[model samples]
Target: MTLVEAQIDRIVGPTHHFGGLGVGNIASQQHQGQTSNPRAAALQGLDKMRTVASLGVPQVILPPQIRPPIDLLHDLGFTGSLTEILPQVANDAPELLSAVMSSSAMWTANAATVTASVDSAHGTPTMTVANLSSSLHRAIEPQQTLCDLQRLFASFATIIAPLPGGAAMRDEGAANHMRLGSDLESPGIHIFVYGDQAPLPHRFWPRQTLAACQAVARQHGLPPENTFFLKQHPETIDAGAFHNDVVAASHHNLFLHHASAYYRADDTLAQIQRRFDDLHADGLRRIEIPESELSRTDAISTYLFNSQIVSSSTDQRPTLLCPMQVAENSCAASIVQRWIDEGLFADAKFLELRQSMSGGGGPACLRLRVPMKTRELSDLKTSCQWSASLDRALRQVIQEDYPESLDRDDLTNWQIAEKCLAAARRIQDLLAPTR
Candidate 1:
């Protein structure tokens, strides 16, 4: 087992640990024109959540409005609470106000609603030339929201991959060129840039990513050799490939897959299949199921049979994490089903919320896990009260009377309730409060 996998086994006892997770509001007007269906986005979010839940960790939900969305999360069996923590309000001290008045009365004049003009000359006048209406800018920027969401879930020691520079700095190309320095201080934090092409023509992200990793190593008081850079095979930038890179790198193992040639759709599957075939041929009998199978039965069966045959030949067992798709399935939901079908993933209580976004990928693809010192399993059990409360809340929501059209097996109250109970129990155990 890789060091991270081992440590996680120790800390949460075979339960996986994911670090970044949040709920994205696809119901907003901004995404209406971009996606074919808003419900797909929501379904994707729920699916990712289910994936996280299946790992046996509390999937943290960060939404602007926490309560209403908690119902959907409950349906996915998330035991974590839906809570909002507003950013620290900027202080407007008298000295700061005096400075602002001296610099630009325009700002002071705009505050007239709060206070009458102090003096005609002393009072600031709003600058018509530079004044930007708040109404025009009220929409939340994805990057800023991501940073704030990271802060809110600091306890998870999460890191956020900022939106690609092109995505963040629409017009300022140079801004995107700025890479993270090699000496950052947050060990738990990592940034996963989305696009394949760097915002700037000459700049490469791998170099900057390496530097950031070094910084994280320094912060953790580890040697630079301890840090490694793992990138996706260009063609298979899908969730499974991303996670495999993370797991391999976390154990100080080099990713043998080449990104340039292995990412093609036809080539991607062939490459992955070949890798598994090679492993079997080499007498390495264990194989973990890729997360891509939740939606693809044929692929799952093929892999399972192949791995089982290989195991039988080698007298070693092959394990599958249960195939799950990051595109439309909830990690928790799929994982639960996997657990129900095969008992491969043990201790479903230590999984952490890794990454969640409106259009990118699931939690597993958003963050990377590093090997760390492990803790005893007994230290991880959570409280039963919270689980009970979550179950009650889910029951209340799903059992409510609604339009007939809204009712379906996927939306059944019983299914939601059962998942909620399982999630609550798992979460309470994972995040058990200290005495």
Candidate 2:
């Protein structure tokens, strides 16, 4: 039973713009009201999937959700055709219009938290669609996201219903979760990082709740002994480390994070090391970037901790797929070189994700990883699989239909809305499951 981790990436939508909807993410706010190139943004995302596939790793595609969710507008007491509603909303309230036009779905890391069959009692992969109860723009995603997940994987995986309770049980999904094991085939230790266990001082409110993390563990049937819940440092969240992924990342046997990732970072690592050693004969590799070396401000700005650590075919250690910003940052570049010298990583691949990066996402944020058995992959639906043909087809659509550039004002244009809707539908059709 060979298990491999597959990168499930979502295609950037036609409405990709910088409305600055995210509350805690500093990058998103900093670039607010700027013009965005939807065509380039969507193409860059596809190119990333192509790059991941070229590395001899399995890659999967998740379709983007349709933008200008008019149903939401109708629910808000707007009555008319999409054209009529667009101008009405623009006149009545521009903020409400911006919320519906958000293209945040491209960052699929917040899509869901998945449990590999190796770690579950049922011996089948399980996914709990994130409720994303923190913000208005994101909160509207779960229903559509759940529908898409079910359509794609219902035959092979157990899709757990989103957690029921509201904001009190706010769930931000896999962005705040980490799993590490000796190998992909073995049972792993689950570390659910939450922002607040007890309310303390902070600049921004935490998105994930302790109750949500515990509920996900229970729903997935993860063994108690192998599961641990850790609290994110209050200061880190205030520093713009909105989710744990902003401060930490994990591969099969390696746990790489910043010193300020948790409230009690040293003790947390000790407990994780103990659990990892107990589960498998191999020990966990811990790499903690200290504040003296890289301040929390630098980590958030460069998105150094948001890189994806993936297994390499040519080397024993994994490769770091990081944003180009890290390579440009002198301090970040030096640390990455040090890691390579120490054999912590095989090498680093700098990806050009400026569009997504400016919107507060990086290489890791653009994906959702699912560890699947070869047998599971073999029997999986083919439409979601990545290949040269699918890549070409998606690129063509972006070139032909997606907007060259968009501003906040364009979000309220009915013609722009129509084009976006059509492009999303075309991509959705292209990735629809084949019988």
Candidate 3:
């Protein structure tokens, strides 16, 4: 009955582009309308998964949802086939076209909030697909994410539908959720960070609400004593730290965050430490980066805190998987070195995830962490689990089927849409379970 943490990463889709659809994400908006390299994006994602697997951790791949959402387009009153509708909509309403063709699903961190089998009262994993009701493009994600999760984990986990009541119950999934303990196998303290809707004057808005986190906790049957809800610092949200992960990351005993990550920074840390003390003998490690050292603007731009801290078999301490942006920034690089010097991490590995970084995601945003019994994972029916052969096959699909370059305008062409479909099909086929 050994439990292990597995990372489920989304394969960057053929429709990967700078749609600038994320309202609160600065990078997304800054790179809007720029040409994107789908082939390179997909390949970079695969390389990331491969690197994670090489660290002696289990890595799983989640295929991207179909782009353009043809059904939705039809419902939008676009007539005829994809060829006709795509060009017609692109010509008449380019923004709407970009929204429908978004590949933001590649950020699986927003797909769901998972309660590990060890922590749930049912003694099985529980996953709640995010509603993503804050934006039009992301709002269309829950049902498809649910379908994919059911196919992958329904055998051994309870899959909860997205919270009802739409926008009022906005949920951004695991990006706003964190589990902290001595290790993933241990029952840990669940920290749900949420934000208030922005008042007028600010263009960006916060996505995760307090109500959504409470609902997920109740649905997963998490112990009330062990679960805590914290508020995101409004100023940080306004500063483009849309999700808590942008300013904070927690792994096991390490709670790495910016000083202004929460509403009442000192009180929040005290509350977290009190809970950690109740659960374990060792103290919780807190690495708070002050604003003087690195401003919130730099934090968002460099994505320093968005790094993933994952356990490794090769070392006693967990390794920090950071985006190369952190390395390029002198201040951020020094901060990471300090973490190593303080023994917070055994070491740090900087990955080149520029494509995802440009799309407003970094190493942490690209994967969803799921803790499950090792035996259960082996018995799973889906072929999403990583294997050397499957990895090779997926690389082949990306190289052969994905476009070398694509502009937002290119999405209107019939050939581009067909190629997207073809690539998705190849990936789906590869992930289909063997009879």
Candidate 4:
């Protein structure tokens, strides 16, 4: 059965997908953004709201660094607040320092030291850099950082199976080399890692991560039939060099591939029309607004221009496009205007947020969703609120005890995560129906 089909079978359970909206900071930094500042924080909050509204899913997971302002969450109708987890770092070690640092240097210097010192004093050092830089570089390089960040965001809503290849195996040129397809199942999560020609050492490393995922599945007593692996196409040597060879190898129910063509002055409107025609023929969906159009100071004009095309098109299938206008101008008003003008997205829901410190992503990039019973939405909101309350309580506790017992080895990384997890579990259990 397809992953979506399997998820449908769950009448009542914790079946969900956890997507990582690509590294939020990467985009934010590229755009000269910061999440900590009040204005940026407010924008982040709006973005989170858009995520919930657009996806129609409540359990959106994000990096610990991405906490939206509480008021923004409330405005977005988020009954539940943000749940902050340690971002998944590239290192194999469970050290909290490595995990946080892998994603953020500032996090490493600030939170890592505190967590590490706490862990050490408690006779457990929970922070260590696993020397997985080589592997991390292979998996996500600087040029393809945006793609990696998107993959990270998607991972939160879907099971992200690490592809084979250690850090050395990543192909610097191929954007698709590091990502593996994810599946949403009822009893547990499963992901398929494919591609044979990843850069190096990391290519084979995905197997180990796969094994880890499988173990997690088994521990949950999920059936083997729920798991699957799609093999790589032989001719697919690099990411950029796409041939029908790789496309033919994709056996999953859905295949997502990226395609782009620049529009130059000489190109006529017919050329753009032909380009989209070719794309539809190839089963590719247009999800992002072209970056060129967004660069203009009149971003709203560009958005209107593009929206006209989308509005006129007869196709109803969802297309992925950055609401560049939304990114450039922090408002959903235009989107609503467009919806009214053409009755194009009238049926479609609209979610808009102010840009976050981690720039470039819209609602779609930050949140991941596993199609679930409509009831779960309420559950998610409750869980989110509980998490917020807990975070507030913890912050209060830390402040009250400030400078009184600031020791490095006081709390292990695992212990800290365990504490957080326990609190979440309690909230979850309270919401869950008792036998």
Inter-residue clash pairs, candidate 3: none
lDDT of 4 at 140: 23
Per-residue accuracy of model 4 over 1-435 as CA lDDT, tens digit each: 212200000000010001122221223334431222222323333343333333322333222221112233344343442232222111222332222222221111111000111112222111111111223311222322233223322222222222234443322111111111222222221223333323323212221222333333333333344344333322222221121111111111222221121112123323323433443333212222333423222322223222111111233322233344443554434443453465334333333333321332333323222333233223333323223453344334223321221111222233433443343343334333221
In candidate 4, how many Å is residue 315 off? 17
Candidates 2 and 3, the one with greater lDDT: 2
Distance from true location, Cα of 381 in model 1, Å? 7.7
Each model's total of backbone clashes = 33, 0, 0, 55
Give candidate 3 misplaced runs (Cα > 4 Å): 197-201
- TM-score per prediction, in order, is 0.32, 0.97, 0.96, 0.33
lDDT against the true structure, per candidate, is 0.24, 0.88, 0.87, 0.26
Error of 2 at 226 (Å): 0.7
Model 2 C-alpha lDDT per residue in residues 55-146, reported as the tens digit of each score: 77788898888888888888899999988999999999888777888889888999999989988877888899999989998988889889
| lDDT digits (tens) for residues 1-435 of candidate 3 | 446778989889898889899968989989998999999998888888988898888888888889878899888888999888987897787779888888899999999999888888878899999999999989888899999898888888999999998878999999999988765367888999998743321556779888999999999999987898888888888888999999999887788888888886577668878988888888788778889998889999999999987787677688899999999999999999988998888899999898999989999999999877777677566478788999999999998999988897698888889989989988988988662
Worst 10 residues of 3 by lDDT: 196-205
**Comparison by lDDT, 2 against 4, better one:** 2
Q: Write the per-residue lDDT of candidate 1 for residues 134-154, one digit (tens) a residue.
A: 111211123323343233322
Q: Count steric clashes of candidate 4.
A: 55
| lDDT over C-alpha atoms for residue 121 of model 4 | 24
Ranked by TM-score from best down, the candidates are: 2, 3, 4, 1
- Number of the top candidate by lDDT? 2
- Report lDDT (Cα) of residue 383, candidate 4: 26
At residue 346, give the lDDT of candidate 1.
33
